[model samples]
Target: MTAEQQTLLEKSYKDFTRNGALLSDEAKEELRKIDAALAVVKLKFGENVLAETQAYQLHLTDAADLSGLPEGTIEAAHDLAKSLDKEGWIFTLDYPSYIPFVTYADKRELRKEIALAAGRKAFQANEHNNEKNVLEIVNLRHQRAQLLGYSSHANFILEERMAQRPEKVNAFLQDLLDKAKPAALKEFQELQDFAKKLDGIEQLEKWDSAYYAEKLKQQKFDLDDEKLKPYFNLAYVLAGAFDVAKQLYGLSFTEVDTIDKYHEDVQTFEVRDENDAFVAIFYADFFPRKGKRNGAWMTSYKPQYWKDGQEERPHVSIVCNFTKPTASRPSLLTFNEVTTLFHEFGHALHGILADTTYPTLSGTSVFWDFVELPSQIMENWCYEEACLANFAKHYETAEVIPMALVDKIKESASFQEGMATLRQISFGLLDMGWHGANPSLIEKVKDFERTQFASTSLYPDVADNAMSTSFSHIFDGGYSSGYYSYKWAEVLDADAFDFFKQEGIFNRAIGEKFKTNILAKGGTEHPMVLYKRFRGQEPRVEPLLKRAGLL
Candidate 1:
């Protein structure tokens, strides 16, 4: 946390505790001040992140230097070049730039070079390194939670989350690990054997993971991301999202050219209700840059809140680092990227469609476990044929995605899902290892990370590659011990979407039930209560396991 953030958090705690508002004008005023202070903390934190982050970007000149880049990437480079003063191209630390370079770049040494460079963030001997920020954040969080009368940061965050206690979180993570570790080990062994056969490599290095995984995928499934990307262009995917939102709810989006944005690529839109009343403002920042983080997330300029009487519509933004379109071709996406866009947009919908009395109870302000239900449930639509037809058009050919291709997507959906589940469980466990218990003994961070990941190791651990240094989800973002929310939410989303599958994806009654019971209710009730209202029974892991072929 920054100085400003700390100051505000202190004020909020002091004012809230002193006032102790069960109900009164002074109490209301104090609570409002607390709310306003939290808003400031949110904005300043986001601004510092964006400003400090955008304060740097790795630039390159000479078109030949771009030899390792995909053709579409080169075009994005040109776009960045034009934005900056560069003559040839500019690439940022965005995932679009870094991920492709690691997975597909022919230059092995450059891939390792950048891979290590990217991971050392907030820890490297520079201002960009975040070691102090991370440590202070954990300590401050622990302090704040203790003020609220909790033992640690995890206890504070888990109050409303589905995994209500640290013990529950530990049990949930360990149970999944117990199921997934063997499968992950088997998968790693198979990949090692495959790599040895393909290149006579005695040792499988960290850099070799994605490159070989892609090859193994193609050999096993007769399909690869490069082949599927052409069918999942950016524009059609956006249109598909619009269609889904429209069908499920009565919302419509109008692409408006009437507002200011932080970036050139960020297109703005006016969202409306079925009656065409103005609803919300949407912003889409879809390309990578040095100034931006390396993942997709939904943020808000204004939150939907009702105070006294008037309702304030939110300004929601979905930011991601997807591949850029070349002059020769429009922006095409790998299937993973396609699902990511939908997931973030679902978060946007939760914010935009928010109809609540207080900003505190507004969209996605619910329990950590339930928040991802809307987002992840949206991704399930990506695998549906009817959903694909609504978007999924070839940029050049203007043809809908082929049925055969969709079949491949569904068939491969569960491929190596056990390995994937294990990976998530490992991260969740690592998170627990950090905050669910006393991390004060962890004088050195890397040593602690090694113990946490020892059960989940596939490739040899690199001394330079530390997840703690760049783990924005825990260190910087509000996740902390809640990083397990991803897996926890997966259980909820799969079970919730299974309800959707049973009734109908676009069934108005079920959709309304979701909007009313899940999305609209927000933090008013326990997440499981809201979920059981929608699902009729307690959520089970079997649907998730069945989806992942773990069953």
Candidate 2:
């Protein structure tokens, strides 16, 4: 082997040993059993959550109870009820149906009902309760860590992450908490006062938060999502995202009918380089249905790699539970959904442009915190006027979004910056609290979460609702202690985009440098080394703070 290859193999050997390959045969056997059991438990945990989610449905026979919900939401709900041979409207815990009801519905009691139903998923006394599953999962994780001679699960995982150790992750979360607390408190007070004046809301309950926040936002900025959705038809926004990629990377996408798709809702495309060479296969799946989970994300069917003296391309897919089109309208996306599309597409670009050799270390195989930079940075373009002008045209009139509305959108970007930052910091802290130290003492899930979330608490605690029960990120998914990566990557993205702003949003030379240095490099080297080679320096928090209006 070459010297570099030999060195990498040596490091890999050390990694395997440190990760438990060096354990005694008996200990390794125990670990294998623990892993098998834990896998089943984790699968059960996720399935229970989904079952609990699908189990509940609110059937509203009174239009009065549906007051303040948008026309589109009502139509969808009506369609749902009709499909079930029921009357009036039906709203479930699905985000597309649930978010609008909780955010815009004026019926405080019903909103509380919906919110509690959501938060109470897998928490109640039922076949799908996750309380026991959570306890067993954590215990098994701690046992596995101990078998491997690690202090905690976080300590075991952080060894491979940029943060390196739990102490560093703790310090990082604490620092952000310290900075965000003051502003968060102020924002909470203002929101409470606004709620009181607007609706005589006495307590500002958990359910009241989103409803009032939306009202206050509209009152302050004279803007709401419904007013913005008409300009963000899914087809046009997809084209716009593609255009942005083409502008930045000299890539082109052509829809192809021959490519096989796992689902009919999925669209397939052939991606090509500037010289018209085949690059990657892209698949997009939008809209939600039964047997499908909620939310949005990017995934890969095949990894890019070099084998047998040839480079094998990748197949990338982005899946989202966007609002489905109805008889009256196309699938018009909220501004938040627009940014989500850009974020996932950014990850797609990372996969599409991967120029690495090893499949295990290729395309988004970088440190968890560093993996979000490309994705989060793409969100910035959604706010740019030129970017918006390219595709934010009304579906009916074909007129571009008014500059006035764009100004409102930009102005509202940081409307509740303080509260939002604190919410994120709270999640990161909660994650650390769970995984960074001994969690064997956490007897009751809700009580433990209350203690961890004490300082960051904004809304009044609901007796029946708990976040940990449904927090699939740490339990069923890979995030575990790495939820803080979202904030960490925000800092990187904010600083990186500041560079783009200094040059120009679509500057070709700068884009090429970013592509060659960051996007194409993947996990071939240390993430910090690759990042510094791209940015010419370490990232700065000042840029993120400034963009968040927290500075």
Candidate 3:
């Protein structure tokens, strides 16, 4: 907190944007010392993420313990429990175990208890409490940003994004909120009305959101995840994504067993061009466990670049929190999760297929706003008829998805677009509320968070539950003030998809242009230039608005 200490931290940053490869020989030596301290801190960081994902499992060895579980739940429980030296079943913090229990567990008290158990993490008086660690991380980040001549962390980060600066990010978030507020209000009213009528519930609580929303969606569209999940077995869904990529870009993938992986669950593949030459290595890690985080992300353990007279192939991994395969069933994906897989894999493809010369400027390492373009645009392919038929098939019958169901999926594509946009904008604004301002005057973190959510708060804040205490993205993760990039990239993705829709979703000319201009170029040039080179002009908001049915 001292000025002298702050200056030292700032000086060490050396400006990430201006300085290419800030880790030079001299800098690397200095960083070796910094890394020593960072190794200690990051060790705790990695351990906490792993512990949250892997540790503190629930072991139920008795068959009766699986009483209320869904069809395959008991099998998954037994398999997991047996592995951990139990009799009946094993349950951990994996999405398959945790999320279904949270949303559909018939036992309300059990759900609440486990929910509290999960929420209580990193807040209790123990080393796992990330509160102090979070504060330290934020302060360190502030110092790093200041070193780069930015007013705040948000300013430093957004400057290189499509949103350009904190001011622009704030403006974009607010502008979207202006458009989305009415739709959100209408959606909430409808959900509340439905809850009152169907469940005779006069009050809606935090727990009611997902449950009731599923109910409303089923009533409105005659569609629910369970009915659709049968058609979205993992291999089919991945094939659907692969088919879309091939149609759109002439890219191909072949399963390869030669590569080394950190875990047995990971499946490795070799990406290739139409001529069958090697492109990149793609690792897919699907399932929830203590070792993984709670969301989906695309990460490059090895980046694509030119070094030592050879272009190094990239290794891209897509880590997702999906339900593990139960005893009777393989992992079945909800349509939304299918889109998410497509999104992360799109990011993986961007990295794996990268043809760049510099590591810093490779794959999805472009501007924050533009980085989402490939991933988000790939979600578009999920809706195409040819695309779906390629991957969407009945798990048991092995029949391709019915065309009528594909039609239903497309019709429901914009079903909750307005409400979804509202949620995304609200989070981005919340991010701005924190890093965009001076927190010194704000002593209470909970009160500060409440104010940030004031304009968008649908459910009353649970006094015992504070989101800031556990918001890993803005605190320990790199998002901070840049969380708005999701929506920011939506604009780019939607617009870019329009170009493909005009030509053909799989037009090779356009795909090659995009590969050369956008994916392969990375951060070597301004994102706008790369975007325009591909789209032949600047991206537009109209396409996004149209896609969201807001127009």
Candidate 4:
């Protein structure tokens, strides 16, 4: 058998044995019950979070309450109210609504109200509360891990991951925390001082963080999302992403009419190589509706594999919840949304470029910690002048973005990065707190979370807010004990992008090396081995630290 086939077989065997294939029938029955209960509880946890998110709406009858909002945000809110048969504007906890309101809204009380509402999702005294669900999830996970002969759920999950142990994950997080905490404290203090000087505020609350930070960023860098949005119309940004793929990987995307789509909002494309050979089918869903969940992600409808001596291409999709275009304007993306588009498109490219034999080992089927490298690395391009020159054009005037603004975008890239790193570390530590040890004794989810967040706490704690209750990444989704993978992959992405910088952002040689050694290779080999083949060495943490401005 080929080495790839041997690796697949050995992995399959390990998966079975690790999942209790060798257990007695009675033990297996227990495992079955645990799995079944976990599925129900996890679904319930996500449903409750979504339902709670959908249930709340800050309805405003007076236009005075809409002070400090962007014109587009107000228009979107007005349209939402019109749809609901209401007289005034409406804003929900959805990111598209909530983010702009908090960051740009003038009314401090209103921002506080919405921010608190957002933080209290699934944590309130309501039918949708997830405290019990959180407790049950951790307890059941711990029980399952023990039953599977592991010390903890984290241990069981990490066994197949690049980290391979809870200790290493903890040490990695702690090392970052140690480097980041001092910087975060300084940044927090600076933000507080800035807020106080600007508004005569003695105390800076959670809601004030984004508002003041954005204000300070504008003050220091002369940049803000509002200034950059006109140049980042969604369609243009996507086309730019396609162009990047074309320039780097010889891929072309053409929208096709023959493909049946689940929704009219979804755009279907036939992806092909430079030689016009079929690569993959791509679908992009770029709006939010009544039933859609929040956030953006890339998913696969079909996997690429060799079958019957023929190559079966993959079907890939990227879904996002960008603000819809209003009647007066096109759908303009915030700078962050631009990066999000590139990130998901990067994942789509991974799936589209897969060249593996076994379906299980195909695109994005590698270590959990390694999966974010492609996505995160792609985000780096959004900040590059060479790349942004292709897509960053004003929708109204067709004007290319000024190099000055591009410089500002690059300058402000590390704005509040210290606090951001600390925030991520807090989540990683919280994940370990739940799964790295026995969670059966965790009596109160909020209390447990508070303990875990002790080292990373910035603002005063909100009595009504508990992040774990709605942290679906660990409870409802597949993160479980793997939330640290985001930072873990950042290390890889920053280092890998450094290599691209030394070569050239659009250097085809480096791009082909990345496509062959990483994206196309998938799970056929160890992630480090593949990464080394592309990068020529193990990744260095210094690159990530330098990028984050935490060094």
lDDT over C-alpha atoms for residue 279 of model 3: 83
| TM-score top scorer | 4
Residue-level lDDT of model 4, residues 289-387, one tens digit each, is: 998989999999999999999999999999999999999999999999999999999999989999999999999998899999999999999999999
In candidate 4, the residue pairs with backbone N, CA or C atoms under 3 Å apart (3 or more residues apart, or in different chains) clash, namely none
Sorted by TM-score, highest first, which candidate order results?
Answer: 4, 2, 3, 1
Candidate maximizing lDDT: 4
As a whole number from 0 to 100, the lDDT of residue 184 in candidate 1 is 78
Give the C-alpha miss distance for residue 230 in model 1, angstroms. 2.3
Candidate 1 yields a Cα-based lDDT of 0.76
The alpha-carbon lDDT assigned to residue 203 of candidate 2 equals: 79
Q: Residues 273-377, candidate 1, lDDT per residue (tens digit)?
A: 899998899999997755566688999888888767888988999998887666678789989999999999989998988876667667777767778888998
What do the candidate models score in CA lDDT, each in turn? 0.76, 0.90, 0.74, 0.94
TM-score of each: 0.86, 0.98, 0.88, 0.99
Worst 10 residues of 3 by lDDT: 3-12
Badly placed stretches (over 4 Å) of model 1 are 1-69, 74-92, 307-309
Clashes within 3 Å, all models in order: 5, 0, 11, 0
Q: In model 1, which residue pairs have backbone atoms overlapping below 3 Å?
A: 54-291, 92-290, 122-129, 122-130, 123-129
